[model samples]
Target: MGAKAYFAVAAAAISLSIVAATPAIAAPRAAENYVAMGDSYDSGVGTRTYDSSSGDCRRSPVAYAPLWAKANSPASFTFIACSGARTPDVQKQADQLTSSVSLISLSVGGNDVGFASVLTSCQLGSDQSCFDKVAEAVNQARTTLPAKLDATYSKIKSKAPSAKVVVFNYPRLFDLGTCGLGGLSKAKRERLNQAADTLSGIISGRVSAAGFRFADLRDRFNGHGICSSAEWLNGLSWPINESYHPNTNGHSQGYLAAFKAAIG
Candidate 1:
């Protein structure tokens, strides 16, 4: 071929190479910006894949927020929920929220009226002391917890005005009988279960009043509590703090199902 013809061919090849090398611009995502906020139940405290990189938050990738985001492919997911968070702690988590956020899933209030302390006292103390501690917690749940929940929920709404907030409650811990694995006596279990019911009722009432969806897991965990043959919640662990939290099955089956349904 002549020099001029060869040069023209080279130019054409170069143009084709350039075109092939250029990357295609991806289509924008049509998913919401989802933020998960609240306490240990929302943070996956007892899950195997706990992310220490998130510090004391103990955020597991298997946690419902991350699981839901993975399944649905949200535009973005921010998990600000921490372990041992009370209603006040949730206020800090809500700081991560913005007007652009489209979905919020959280589980708070378990720590607000000292639910853990009550459980600990009941699990370790004498029957009389256990009942007394529970009574105190019940009283606080009736009187103090409502105002705290209202303030936190209101703040969350204000921060993420357009977001659909779904607040999840803790599961009932017992089946009214001892499985003989944990230390909780039958009578103690009844009192603790009543406390759980009280807490759930308080949260449900406030969540409904705030126009937020309440994801009730009590019924779902009926046959899967700590005393069940197939337990979904951890019994007394050596660390003690890890006990009473949801196990892997609880997150995958209990919380995930309720969460997906609530969001839908």
Candidate 2:
């Protein structure tokens, strides 16, 4: 073979080897027809900024879902989650789903187990009352919530069978640490956190059974509960409805972070 031809062949082989050794850049996540559904946590209840058109639902622009939509610029984005929404309300929200939807994010079941009421009772009533309320909520979470969650998930699947649904569980509200005056007693806080754990387990289990991704926020929001030095959750804020929900920081740092991890 000619020296010039041999040199050209060697250079081609070297170029091929370099190409093979270089890592491929990961493609960006595909845009989708994305829908956000569920309750107050998903609706941005504690964020204060809300869309007037959402009315009593109080959907906030800064909530995790909208933040995700704003960042990703999905093919389509719909936010229908409402404050005070229970599992049945979620079933209705499923009506917004369609076969073309490619992504969904949901945070539900807290209201199904009357978490808001439990929090109110714990804060305003006696310690025993708090324990009693926590127990009741736990019982409901264990017994009836599974079926409600399963049915709601099924409805969403039926509506948008091709969508990738991600179910986000609630963070533990209390840090169980010292907080100056007017907070629940340590015993009450422990009970409430335990109840939250039970609920998280149930939701995670049901989400897995339904073949969907479960994003557990408890760990993500660790050291950021109501009593923490850098708290992400609210503690008895005004406009009482915002009392236990995630603040703007929580939605951006906690919920949005978890959702991105789950979807990725």
Candidate 3:
């Protein structure tokens, strides 16, 4: 899909999409005062993807970054999140961060397109071949994600070193117990999580390698994967139409985990 409107939730996965709304008021995010940065996941993409106006940023309450901030005691915060943002968008859009800030988090890397492409490619492949191909894609993310994270985190640090930086990782598609789509084998989902795991490892490792604290949310969300009864993520209907994006629940889980890690 083309770049979505600033405040609009374009066609995305139902499980993962949060429609855009008017730019909501920036709520308090930390005790020591902090700021938030990232893509639609941070902006609550899946919780609800509707616009307060025709052209406002979707500010769903279920979005993880805002929820995480509100969960803690009130502190000053600045938000620079828009849907469909990738690495370059961040470098250009979110540069005014302050040095004395207390915390920061970035939930990204799903837009690299390899995962979706793999999903599509493996849909018609034999079971063994599907598994093998998915494995390869995840492996690629393992190697490439850290460097991208490193550059972004360093830029964030240059603007806000004192802030506690946490790289939020992606969740598994479906529960380990469940895999296979109506048109595809569930084994691919396992491969999807394996990739997510690899990316998570890269993110956590790179963050720690740079002397920053890393919060690994992968294991913490074991059974709550995409197709779980309580479904925390939405692989097919994410971004409401795009599929594979996190939903409101996904953002909530991320926010809860990130906040608890930052303070508790």
Candidate 4:
């Protein structure tokens, strides 16, 4: 073939190949299929430390979901986490899934029996049965949460059959350090985390049985828990008007790790 003709043909072929690799019309639609749901922490309450934004909900833009979704670029997100969301409440609030969705993230079980009040026990210098209280709470949630999650997953799969479900295990509240006004004992705080771990262990099975991904942040946030030097999780006396929630960096740190580790 003539030199000019050969060069022209090679350029055309290269252009065609690039177009094929790029897919001119039907890309994967990475921006859709992401939904974030849950309670006050999910709503990003304390990240801003009392930012006047997000209206009454105080949803921080730097919250976990947003940060995670941003990290997993090209992936769009639908955040529905509020200040007060129980498992049943989220079941009601989560949007109807459409055709396109890659992931759905949610955290719940705080408002079911008034989580703040329950946590208050730990905060109130009531270390006598803190572990026992945590155990009981986990047991109760174990009995009930599976049912709700099963229902929620059923509805989710019905619409976005291929979508991956990710359930976040709430991280540790207090490291072995003083907390609340009473100054919690390290042993008591450790017991609390252990209880949380127990709760996570039970829920992890349920999450897996339901074909979802369970992100375990307990180990990651071990030393940096509520009373840790870094203080990933908050205590009652946080700088933010919001109480006992992860800080901005904390959310991003934990959420991003969970997102990276989670495959559902």
Candidate No. with top TM-score = 2
* Tens digits of per-residue lDDT for model 2, 235-256: 9888888888899999999999
In candidate 3, stretches whose alpha carbon ends up further than 4 angstroms from where it belongs are 1-31, 50-59, 120-136, 178-184, 238-242
Tell me the spans in candidate 4 whose CA falls farther than 4 Å from its real position: 1-32, 49-56, 71-75, 129-132, 177-182, 238-241
lDDT of 4 by residue, 1-264 (tens): 999999999999999998889945644436546877777877888776434655666666788777766666655677777777776777665555666777777777656635466576766646776656666676676677667667766666676777777888778777775555555778777776666676677668777877888888777777787767788766765443466677776787877777667852
Superior by lDDT: candidate 2 or candidate 3: 2
Considering TM-score, which of the candidate structures 1 and 2 is the better prediction for this target? 2
lDDT of 1 by residue, 116-231 (tens): 88888988899899999999988998999999999999999999999989999889987765578556888888888888898899999999999999999998999898778898
Candidate 2 Cα errors over 4 Å, as ranges: 1-30
Rank order by TM-score, top first? 2, 1, 4, 3
Global CA lDDT computed for model 3: 0.64
**Residue range with the least summed lDDT across 10 consecutive positions in model 2:** 24-33
| Model 2 score (lDDT) | 0.91
Q: Pick the candidate with the highest lDDT.
A: 2
Instruction: Return the TM-score for each candidate structure.
Output: 0.86, 0.92, 0.73, 0.77
Candidate 3 lDDT by residue in tens digits, 34-147 = 566677666556665644541344656556666665666546766666666676767655477776677776666665535666666666577787777777776666767667
CA lDDT scores, all candidates in order: 0.87, 0.91, 0.64, 0.71
> In model 1, what is the error at residue 123, expressed in angstroms?
1.3
* Residue 45 in candidate 1, Cα distance off native in Å: 0.9
